[model samples]
Target: MAIAGALIWAAVIGTLIYATRERRRVQSEHAAGLLILWGGAIIPALLLGLLLGYALWLMPDIRPWSAPGEPAGLRIEVEGEQFWWRVRYHPADGPPVDAANEIRLPVGERVEFTLTSSDVIHSFWIPVLGGKMDMIPGRTNRLTLRAAKTGTYRGPCTEFCGTSHALMAFSVVVMEPDAFRDWLADEARPSPGAGAPGGELFIANGCPACHTVRGTEATGAVGPDLSHVGSRETLAAGIMPVDVEAIASFISKPDAIKPGAQMPAFGMLPEADIAAIAAYLEGLK
Candidate 1:
């Protein structure tokens, strides 16, 4: 971008200087026409054509390698929903680890993302990590990324999905290799202990039909997994900080937090019950 900007400014400034200084020197009408052809048309065309050719040569490599028994690198599947990201880490030894919104990857490793959409076309973009890839419904797209540094990067849904598209965002946390392995191991485990309030409520209140809290009987795969939901930094696709209060509010009023969210508002539940559910979810970590 800086190079392009410099070239554009250089062209504009050179034209301005030449027009003011050389206008009087060019006496013949034919010279002006020739100048317009070579300077105005030919030069800019060649410059732009070269830029286009370079971009085409450097187009982001997007080949879906998330299929079974493929690509020796770490593979992840991401499903784009209306206002959130459903993530799955394919592990060799056990069931796929289910997560939402945030992803933790090891630094200096090639990570392949298999992107798809459940409802609408959404673009997955983590600017500092790699190029953008579209997630189209019924179609799978892919992007291979390599993060050089260890830090948190923003992942936002670039394609305009719906009313809540602007709020659809996540975080990519790059950690050391050993740290990431430990984290992934931790993530693959089931929810620890019995969720007294939220566990029973989540099961009996029909929440299990859509969400999965591993280790318990709430193993529904329709929505984001809540096995480690309390450990996330943000709730509702980075809309708010993760806390028991926010979780309780989001549980009862998802529509209020995300205008076009798919989760139906559980406004009918009593405030105490909602708090209990939130408290239980908050302790999963």
Candidate 2:
């Protein structure tokens, strides 16, 4: 397209120079009318029409949505929150698995995603894998993606939904099919560290009212699931490292790290209790 535009510009300049140099000649009106009919209208119309057609031809490959009536074996539903992502995997042969902040996919397999927003508008975009799709409240959108290679990539909320929109992000881990299967199987199970001393403190501190740790008494659904938080690569929607200190710090004061976080600060808790809780969470894997 750039080359075509450059060629057209050169032709216009050449025509103008020729016309200026031949100003002494009395050109017929028929010649000017012909130039206007072809150069001004027909040529541009043809060029733009060809470009439009080429773009339309590439549309399917660019926005690779699932075809009608196609059977999608795996479906992932991602809900955009204020500053986090709620991910759920629905496998064809098993029950749905709930996760948060991170997405794991099998390379070479096409996966369809159902995206929506819980509060304001947000856009789901994994630039390495596919284009962005809007996630709006009370509306659902679908996008399909297939990773050709195994690697880790980052996805962000492209739309400005709230004060902490810049802090909202997620991780995409593409793995071999077998590895993805194994990982998903393990993710389906409950948290292994659900019986630790910190788990008791977590429940006692009213953490269960918002978060859920499978296999434990914490069954709240208002926030991200902590079933395998320690196993994930990052914390707080990929803003912090997944470690005891980060967890403790986030728990103590979420707003300090994420300005518009919905999770209230637990700074009043004893330092020892906070450390114990963070340790328990770190052992969730």
Most lDDT-accurate candidate: 2
Collision count for each candidate, in order: 0, 0
Candidate 1, which ten residues in sequence have the lowest lDDT sum?
A: 58-67
RMSD values, in order shown: 3.5, 3.8
Runs off by more than 4 Å, candidate 1: 1-4, 21-24, 27-71, 91-95, 193-197
**Per-residue CA lDDT of candidate 1, range 42-108, in tens?**
9889988998987876554334344576556778899999889999987545567789999888899
Give the clashing residue pairs of candidate 1, or none.
none
lDDT of 2 by residue, 129-186 (tens): 9789999999989888888999999999999998999999999999999999999999
TM-score of every model? 0.83, 0.82
Model 2, CA-based lDDT: 0.92
RMSD of 1: 3.5
